[model samples]
Target: MHEDIHVGGGLVTAFVAYALAAFVILIILRFAFARLRFSRYVANAPLAEAGLYVCVLALLIAFI
Candidate 1:
Protein backbone atom coordinates (compact mmCIF):
# COMPACT_ATOMS: atom_id res chain seq x y z
CA MET A 1 0.00 0.00 0.00
CA HIS A 2 2.88 2.36 -0.66
CA GLU A 3 2.34 5.69 -2.37
CA ASP A 4 5.44 5.15 -4.46
CA ILE A 5 7.28 2.29 -6.04
CA HIS A 6 10.95 2.09 -7.00
CA VAL A 7 11.89 1.02 -10.49
CA GLY A 8 15.15 1.31 -12.40
CA GLY A 9 16.61 3.48 -9.62
CA GLY A 10 13.68 5.91 -9.49
CA LEU A 11 10.50 6.37 -7.53
CA VAL A 12 7.15 6.67 -9.23
CA THR A 13 3.70 7.06 -7.77
CA ALA A 14 1.76 3.85 -7.15
CA PHE A 15 -1.05 5.45 -9.13
CA VAL A 16 1.15 5.18 -12.19
CA ALA A 17 1.06 1.41 -11.89
CA TYR A 18 -2.70 1.43 -11.71
CA ALA A 19 -2.94 3.81 -14.62
CA LEU A 20 -0.69 1.67 -16.78
CA ALA A 21 -2.63 -1.47 -15.92
CA ALA A 22 -5.84 0.33 -16.85
CA PHE A 23 -4.32 1.50 -20.11
CA VAL A 24 -3.42 -2.07 -21.05
CA ILE A 25 -6.94 -3.17 -20.25
CA LEU A 26 -8.23 -0.31 -22.34
CA ILE A 27 -6.12 -1.42 -25.26
CA ILE A 28 -7.66 -4.87 -25.09
CA LEU A 29 -11.09 -3.30 -24.76
CA ARG A 30 -10.41 -1.21 -27.84
CA PHE A 31 -10.18 -4.34 -29.98
CA ALA A 32 -13.28 -5.81 -28.44
CA PHE A 33 -15.18 -2.58 -28.89
CA ALA A 34 -14.09 -2.38 -32.48
CA ARG A 35 -15.62 -5.79 -33.14
CA LEU A 36 -18.77 -4.86 -31.25
CA ARG A 37 -19.25 -1.46 -32.88
CA PHE A 38 -19.20 0.24 -29.50
CA SER A 39 -19.38 3.70 -31.05
CA ARG A 40 -22.95 3.09 -32.03
CA TYR A 41 -23.95 2.50 -28.41
CA VAL A 42 -22.61 5.76 -27.08
CA ALA A 43 -23.28 9.31 -28.18
CA ASN A 44 -19.79 10.37 -27.09
CA ALA A 45 -17.43 7.50 -27.68
CA PRO A 46 -14.35 9.25 -26.37
CA LEU A 47 -16.06 10.21 -23.15
CA ALA A 48 -17.18 6.64 -22.64
CA GLU A 49 -13.66 5.42 -23.20
CA ALA A 50 -12.35 7.88 -20.62
CA GLY A 51 -14.96 6.75 -18.16
CA LEU A 52 -13.94 3.15 -18.75
CA TYR A 53 -10.36 4.02 -17.90
CA VAL A 54 -11.43 5.66 -14.65
CA CYS A 55 -13.52 2.66 -13.71
CA VAL A 56 -10.71 0.25 -14.48
CA LEU A 57 -8.22 2.33 -12.52
CA ALA A 58 -10.49 2.49 -9.50
CA LEU A 59 -10.99 -1.26 -9.59
CA LEU A 60 -7.28 -1.92 -9.80
CA ILE A 61 -6.62 0.39 -6.86
CA ALA A 62 -9.34 -1.22 -4.83
CA PHE A 63 -8.45 -4.82 -5.53
CA ILE A 64 -4.77 -4.97 -6.31
Candidate 2:
Protein backbone atom coordinates (compact mmCIF):
# COMPACT_ATOMS: atom_id res chain seq x y z
CA MET A 1 0.00 0.00 0.00
CA HIS A 2 1.18 3.51 -0.90
CA GLU A 3 0.93 6.16 1.73
CA ASP A 4 -0.63 9.50 0.81
CA ILE A 5 1.35 12.59 1.71
CA HIS A 6 -0.32 15.82 2.81
CA VAL A 7 1.21 19.24 2.26
CA GLY A 8 -0.24 21.55 4.83
CA GLY A 9 0.18 25.25 3.95
CA GLY A 10 2.86 24.43 1.43
CA LEU A 11 0.93 25.71 -1.59
CA VAL A 12 -0.29 28.81 0.18
CA THR A 13 3.16 29.63 1.46
CA ALA A 14 4.73 29.33 -1.96
CA PHE A 15 2.02 31.49 -3.50
CA VAL A 16 2.45 34.23 -0.91
CA ALA A 17 6.20 34.12 -1.28
CA TYR A 18 5.99 34.47 -5.07
CA ALA A 19 3.46 37.30 -4.78
CA LEU A 20 5.62 39.20 -2.30
CA ALA A 21 8.69 38.74 -4.47
CA ALA A 22 6.82 40.02 -7.53
CA PHE A 23 5.51 43.03 -5.64
CA VAL A 24 8.99 43.95 -4.47
CA ILE A 25 10.38 43.55 -7.98
CA LEU A 26 7.62 45.73 -9.45
CA ILE A 27 8.25 48.46 -6.86
CA ILE A 28 11.95 48.50 -7.65
CA LEU A 29 11.19 48.68 -11.37
CA ARG A 30 8.76 51.54 -10.77
CA PHE A 31 11.42 53.58 -8.99
CA ALA A 32 14.03 52.82 -11.62
CA PHE A 33 11.67 53.86 -14.40
CA ALA A 34 10.72 57.05 -12.58
CA ARG A 35 14.37 57.94 -12.09
CA LEU A 36 15.05 57.41 -15.80
CA ARG A 37 11.97 59.45 -16.90
CA PHE A 38 10.72 56.36 -18.69
CA SER A 39 7.08 57.39 -18.59
CA ARG A 40 7.76 60.41 -20.76
CA TYR A 41 8.61 58.10 -23.65
CA VAL A 42 5.70 55.73 -23.22
CA ALA A 43 2.40 56.50 -24.94
CA ASN A 44 0.32 54.54 -22.41
CA ALA A 45 1.86 54.25 -18.98
CA PRO A 46 -0.84 52.05 -17.46
CA LEU A 47 -0.72 49.57 -20.32
CA ALA A 48 3.04 49.47 -20.18
CA GLU A 49 2.94 48.81 -16.47
CA ALA A 50 0.53 45.92 -16.96
CA GLY A 51 2.67 44.44 -19.69
CA LEU A 52 5.76 44.77 -17.54
CA TYR A 53 4.03 43.04 -14.65
CA VAL A 54 2.93 40.13 -16.83
CA CYS A 55 6.40 39.80 -18.32
CA VAL A 56 8.00 39.84 -14.93
CA LEU A 57 5.56 37.25 -13.62
CA ALA A 58 6.26 34.99 -16.58
CA LEU A 59 9.99 35.34 -16.07
CA LEU A 60 9.68 34.50 -12.39
CA ILE A 61 7.65 31.38 -13.18
CA ALA A 62 9.97 30.32 -15.98
CA PHE A 63 13.19 30.69 -14.02
CA ILE A 64 12.06 30.03 -10.50
Candidate 3:
Protein backbone atom coordinates (compact mmCIF):
# COMPACT_ATOMS: atom_id res chain seq x y z
CA MET A 1 0.00 0.00 0.00
CA HIS A 2 1.14 3.51 -0.80
CA GLU A 3 0.19 6.90 0.60
CA ASP A 4 -0.48 9.67 -1.86
CA ILE A 5 1.28 12.98 -1.45
CA HIS A 6 -0.71 16.19 -1.29
CA VAL A 7 0.89 19.07 -3.10
CA GLY A 8 0.38 22.82 -3.75
CA GLY A 9 -1.17 23.70 -0.40
CA GLY A 10 1.36 26.42 0.22
CA LEU A 11 0.68 28.02 -3.17
CA VAL A 12 -3.05 27.83 -2.59
CA THR A 13 -2.70 29.37 0.86
CA ALA A 14 -0.61 32.19 -0.53
CA PHE A 15 -3.19 32.84 -3.24
CA VAL A 16 -5.98 32.98 -0.69
CA ALA A 17 -4.00 35.32 1.51
CA TYR A 18 -3.24 37.56 -1.43
CA ALA A 19 -6.88 37.64 -2.49
CA LEU A 20 -7.96 38.63 1.02
CA ALA A 21 -5.41 41.39 1.11
CA ALA A 22 -6.48 42.66 -2.28
CA PHE A 23 -10.13 42.66 -1.20
CA VAL A 24 -9.29 44.62 1.91
CA ILE A 25 -7.27 47.10 -0.07
CA LEU A 26 -10.09 47.53 -2.56
CA ILE A 27 -12.59 48.14 0.23
CA ILE A 28 -10.30 50.66 1.89
CA LEU A 29 -9.72 52.47 -1.36
CA ARG A 30 -13.42 52.52 -2.15
CA PHE A 31 -14.18 54.14 1.17
CA ALA A 32 -11.29 56.53 0.99
CA PHE A 33 -12.26 57.67 -2.50
CA ALA A 34 -15.86 58.14 -1.44
CA ARG A 35 -14.79 60.24 1.52
CA LEU A 36 -12.59 62.31 -0.76
CA ARG A 37 -15.38 62.89 -3.33
CA PHE A 38 -13.72 60.72 -5.96
CA SER A 39 -16.59 58.29 -6.06
CA ARG A 40 -18.82 60.92 -7.62
CA TYR A 41 -16.57 61.01 -10.62
CA VAL A 42 -16.41 57.26 -10.68
CA ALA A 43 -20.17 56.91 -10.55
CA ASN A 44 -20.55 59.09 -13.60
CA ALA A 45 -18.23 56.78 -15.52
CA PRO A 46 -19.61 53.35 -16.21
CA LEU A 47 -16.57 52.41 -18.28
CA ALA A 48 -14.25 53.06 -15.37
CA GLU A 49 -16.25 50.81 -13.07
CA ALA A 50 -16.29 48.08 -15.69
CA GLY A 51 -12.58 48.42 -16.22
CA LEU A 52 -11.87 48.24 -12.52
CA TYR A 53 -14.02 45.14 -12.12
CA VAL A 54 -12.27 43.45 -15.01
CA CYS A 55 -8.82 44.31 -13.72
CA VAL A 56 -9.54 43.09 -10.19
CA LEU A 57 -11.02 39.87 -11.52
CA ALA A 58 -7.99 39.26 -13.71
CA LEU A 59 -5.67 39.84 -10.78
CA LEU A 60 -7.62 37.39 -8.62
CA ILE A 61 -7.57 34.77 -11.38
CA ALA A 62 -3.87 35.18 -11.95
CA PHE A 63 -3.12 34.75 -8.26
CA ILE A 64 -5.15 31.59 -8.21
Candidate 4:
Protein backbone atom coordinates (compact mmCIF):
# COMPACT_ATOMS: atom_id res chain seq x y z
CA MET A 1 0.00 0.00 0.00
CA HIS A 2 1.13 3.54 -0.68
CA GLU A 3 -0.03 6.98 0.38
CA ASP A 4 0.65 10.37 -1.07
CA ILE A 5 0.69 13.69 0.76
CA HIS A 6 0.96 17.14 -0.73
CA VAL A 7 2.56 19.98 1.17
CA GLY A 8 1.89 23.52 0.08
CA GLY A 9 5.06 25.60 0.01
CA GLY A 10 6.02 23.86 3.31
CA LEU A 11 4.75 24.94 6.76
CA VAL A 12 6.38 28.36 7.04
CA THR A 13 5.01 29.61 3.74
CA ALA A 14 1.51 28.41 4.59
CA PHE A 15 1.68 30.15 7.96
CA VAL A 16 2.81 33.42 6.39
CA ALA A 17 0.07 33.27 3.78
CA TYR A 18 -2.64 32.71 6.38
CA ALA A 19 -1.22 35.41 8.64
CA LEU A 20 -1.17 37.95 5.83
CA ALA A 21 -4.71 37.03 4.80
CA ALA A 22 -5.99 37.38 8.37
CA PHE A 23 -4.31 40.76 8.76
CA VAL A 24 -5.83 42.07 5.56
CA ILE A 25 -9.26 40.78 6.55
CA LEU A 26 -9.04 42.35 10.01
CA ILE A 27 -8.03 45.70 8.56
CA ILE A 28 -10.94 45.71 6.17
CA LEU A 29 -13.36 44.74 8.92
CA ARG A 30 -12.01 47.52 11.12
CA PHE A 31 -12.58 50.12 8.46
CA ALA A 32 -16.05 48.85 7.63
CA PHE A 33 -17.09 48.74 11.29
CA ALA A 34 -15.74 52.22 11.91
CA ARG A 35 -17.37 53.71 8.85
CA LEU A 36 -20.73 52.14 9.72
CA ARG A 37 -20.50 52.99 13.44
CA PHE A 38 -21.00 49.32 14.26
CA SER A 39 -18.80 49.36 17.32
CA ARG A 40 -20.94 51.85 19.22
CA TYR A 41 -23.58 49.23 19.85
CA VAL A 42 -21.17 46.67 21.27
CA ALA A 43 -20.56 46.62 25.01
CA ASN A 44 -17.08 45.14 24.50
CA ALA A 45 -15.51 46.41 21.34
CA PRO A 46 -12.17 44.68 21.75
CA LEU A 47 -13.72 41.32 22.44
CA ALA A 48 -16.02 41.72 19.48
CA GLU A 49 -13.10 42.57 17.26
CA ALA A 50 -11.27 39.48 18.40
CA GLY A 51 -14.25 37.28 17.74
CA LEU A 52 -14.73 38.77 14.32
CA TYR A 53 -11.09 38.20 13.46
CA VAL A 54 -11.32 34.55 14.42
CA CYS A 55 -14.49 34.05 12.46
CA VAL A 56 -13.07 35.71 9.39
CA LEU A 57 -9.89 33.70 9.63
CA ALA A 58 -11.80 30.46 9.94
CA LEU A 59 -13.98 31.31 6.97
CA LEU A 60 -10.98 32.14 4.83
CA ILE A 61 -9.17 28.94 5.72
CA ALA A 62 -12.23 26.85 5.08
CA PHE A 63 -13.13 28.42 1.75
CA ILE A 64 -9.79 29.39 0.31
Winner by lDDT: 1
- Candidate 1, pairs of clashing residues: none
lDDT of candidate 1 over 17-58, digit per residue (tens): 889989999999999999999999999999999999999999
The list of candidate 2 runs beyond 4 A from truth reads 1-13
lDDT of 2 at 28: 97
Sorting all predicted structures by TM-score, with the top scorer first, yields: 1, 4, 2, 3
lDDT of 2 by residue, 1-64 (tens): 1233346843344545555678789889999999999899999998898888878877776777
Which residue pairs in model 4 clash with each other?
A: none
Candidate 3 per-residue lDDT over residues 1-64, each given as its tens digit: 1233345653243545555666676677667767787756765655664566557756766754
For every model shown, what is its TM-score relative to the native structure? 0.90, 0.72, 0.45, 0.72
TM-score for predicted model 2 compared with the true structure: 0.72
Instruction: List the pairs of residues colliding in candidate 3.
Output: none
Better of 2 and 3 by TM-score: 2
Deviation in angstroms for 32 in model 2?
0.5
Candidate 4 per-residue C-alpha lDDT over 16-44 given as tens digits, one digit per residue, 9 for 90 to 100: 56657898989998999999998789999
- The 10-residue segment of model 3 with minimum total lDDT is 1-10
lDDT of 1: 0.94
